[model samples]
Target: MLRKIIHIDMDAFYASIEQRDNPEYRGKPVAVGYGGKRGVVAAASYEARQYGVHSAMASVTALRKCPHLIFVMPRFEVYKTVSNQIMQIFREYTDKVEPLSLDEAFLDVTENKKVMEFATQIAKEIKQKIHCQTRLTASAGVSYNKFLAKIASDYNKPNGLYVITPEKAEKFLEKLGIEKFFGVGRVTAHRMHELGIRNGFDLKQHSEKELVHHFGKAGALYHQFARGIDEREVESEYVRKSLGAEETFAEDLHELVDLLRALDDIAREVHRRAEKRGFLAKTVTLKIKYADFAVVTRSRTVVNYLRTYDQLFDIGKELLLQVDDIEERKIRLMGLTLKNAGTDQVVLTNQPLQLTLEFKE
Candidate 1:
């Protein structure tokens, strides 16, 4: 059976909310984030984006791009309330609604409660309901599957709706850039470009076997995407395997003291989240990203569950010290994670021998 999928994404979510609440911010360049030397822009309004100010860009850089840009601190509690409002609207149509974030979700409406024959109509109604309840706008994409639906949602953005039928999928994909494909990041896009695969048509020229030889498991996915095919389901329930917190620094830290300080903050955050969720884990992992974008992680599994901030910090410190030549490399990011013991989830670490010690009663 052909499944009807709809992907909905809010327009400049945080920034838009700020504008809606504050009339003075309307029609002006607004950024939602802390405006400090070390802060980063979490969201940029359309007006700010016109000035080349965008999310994740340095706060100082954003100021340089748009001198009149107004910065507003994020109100996460209010955002969560709005998220619940939109999710309720989604539930009215179908139960198979998968939320990707606070502002975006995918809905499988093949068998809907409204008995609507057209997916496009459902997308339109959902968008209307969201705006009516939240005074906010959303963009929606409707298609036969998830991949094309997600792409279609972005095609006409900022209070827009787009539909990609089965007949138009292949031709549309052939004209799409490789970078526009799902899961194709900067590094992968560069490699694809080097291999003369700049667009979907170029990607289609290679056989599945040839693609797999060049890109491994992801290559198989690329081949299918190029042919406008994706079999992945809309998973309504998401199972979290680990709890972690990470921070990207405004300036690289080269000193051990600075790294330890950052690690302490991250450890506290992970512990607080774990306690709130009632998540218990026996393993602690320390992750580091260098200035050159090389990532490395080290993990330690203890005899008992990690239940204290002190225990998390101690294990993270130990793992950090085991890293090779840490002083020689400038660290750009630091993170701490607590993983559930006895899970098959892959962990990238420097430890060669992983031994599990157990006591027999």
Candidate 2:
């Protein structure tokens, strides 16, 4: 059956909120961060991004790029309030709403309440209503499936909406770069590039078995993704997946004993956080970062929920043996993660009928 999925992403979410609240910040290169020597940018305004300032970039570096950049510390509480407001807006039209973060979500409106004949009209209405309620801008993308919907949302950005029909899906993916494919991060991108795969078209050149041989389990996903096909459902109801902690060390620790100490700390931290949040997971993932900033991760699925410190540490220790460069290269960071396979509760609310908060000047 043809599905109607819409991906909505806010434009410069944190930065835009700051701009909206502070008149002086308008049209300026504003950033949200600690703004200290050791600080990094949590988010950058459109103006700041123009200066090459981006999220997670060191604040000192962002300042070098734009000497006049203004930093505003993150108000996560405020952001959460805004997120709740937006989620309310999404629930008005459909019960199937999946929030990716504070700024993005997917809506399975195939069986929506409004009975709207076209998803484009629904997208337009949602955009309009968001503006009405929040005085913020949002973009929407409509497609037959989740993958295409996400790509379509990015088709036009910052208050723009784009739709991709089934007929247009193949052509749409054809033009996309490998970097744009979901889950294809830096390391994967590099691997694909080495294999002469630069975009969706190039990826289609390889068969499923061939991709699997090279990339393990992720290759089967590659073959389908290359063909612009994703069978995953629009999961509006999702459980909290992974909860973990990581730290970037200022100096690389070359000693195995030192790395283990750091790993123990990270594991303890993850265990504490998970216990506090009541997060239960059957899988544990250990991530390592080398002095060169290169990263590797090893994960194992256990039969029981990872709640105790011993389990976290033991799995992490076992995985450490797989790394050959622990003593040769400096270990910059280590982390532990726990992933939940399922969830039980779903949030339901009203979807916005329009997109503007008020009339524009």
Candidate 3:
């Protein structure tokens, strides 16, 4: 029997929450983040998005796009509370709910507690509950698999609902842009374009062998995606792969002293969060972005879980020095992350590690 999957995505999660709680922010362009020289936009309201402001954009850049954009500092604790409320609503329908983030999740409602005959109805009810309970809107997509369900959810916008039935999945995917396929980033899209692959239909023309040869193992997945095939299940057991924090500097740093100081601050925050979550890991990764926007990363693994702030900072400093010409290159951003090193979570060889980065804007 085909599965019934529903993907629910909250509309403009952070920014929407702010607007819902603050009547004055409603219908106005609002951005959630610090409006400082070193700040990044964590989330942008739909109004702000109309002006090209988006999440992960520099605060200055967002301001330049929309000078009247209202900046609000993120209240993470409040967001978490709302997220929990939403998750509870998901649990009311099915235990097979896989959360991609606090704002979005995938639900396997084929055997839901409510025993709903149609996943679309489940999605509609869930969306209604969320809005009624939280005073916020959510968009939902329903399909027989995770891929189509996720894509359907995004096909429409805030407060929208869409369904991609099995009958039309292939034709729908054929017309979809190549860039819309999951795991295809800007770099991958450029490579696919060079090979004359611009849409799902062009992608279907290539054999699995040819695609695998061109894009490695991920190419095989792309071949399946073009045919509207995704066998991945909704993994309800949330296993966090990695956690990290990053900060961009107001000005580039070339001095070793300043770099180390920045690393120290970031490490301290990472340790605090890890300690709070009881996330013990044995690997440390350091990411650096140069002034020219080039990025590089270094990682060190140990046998024991890193338990202290000093341990995190010490490893971070070591990784910092490992970077080439640490003192000569101007660095724009730095990040530190901790991974399980295959100790805490079951390692899936076929899956890539997902790192969640909390930007300190």
Q: If candidate 1 were superposed on the true structure by all CA atoms, what would the RMSD be?
A: 7.4
Clashing pairs in 3: none
Give per-residue CA lDDT, model 3, range 1-361, as digits (tens): 9999999999999999999999999999999998986788999999999999999898999999999999999887788889889989999998887888778888899998987798888898999999999999999999988988989998989899999998999999999999888899999999999999999999999999999999999989998889888999998876566878988888899999999989988999898878766677899999999989899999999988888999999999999999999989899999998886455644332122233555543
TM-score (C-alpha, index-matched) for candidate 2: 0.79
User: All candidates' lDDT scores?
Assistant: 0.86, 0.81, 0.88
Question: Per-residue lDDT of 7-42 in model 2, one digit per residue for the tens?
Answer: 999989889999999999999999997777656687
User: Which candidate, 2 or 3, has the higher lDDT?
Assistant: 3
lDDT of 1 by residue, 84-192 (tens): 8888899899988888878888999999999999999999999999899999999999999889999999998889999999999999999999988999999999999
| Candidate 1 structure lDDT | 0.86
What is the Cα-based lDDT of residue 355 in candidate 1?
Answer: 14
Off by over 4 Å in 2: 247-272, 282-336, 339-361
lDDT: which candidate is best?
Answer: 3
**TM-scores of the models, in the given order?**
0.88, 0.79, 0.93
Top TM-score model: 3
Query: How would you order the candidates by TM-score, starting with the best?
Result: 3, 1, 2
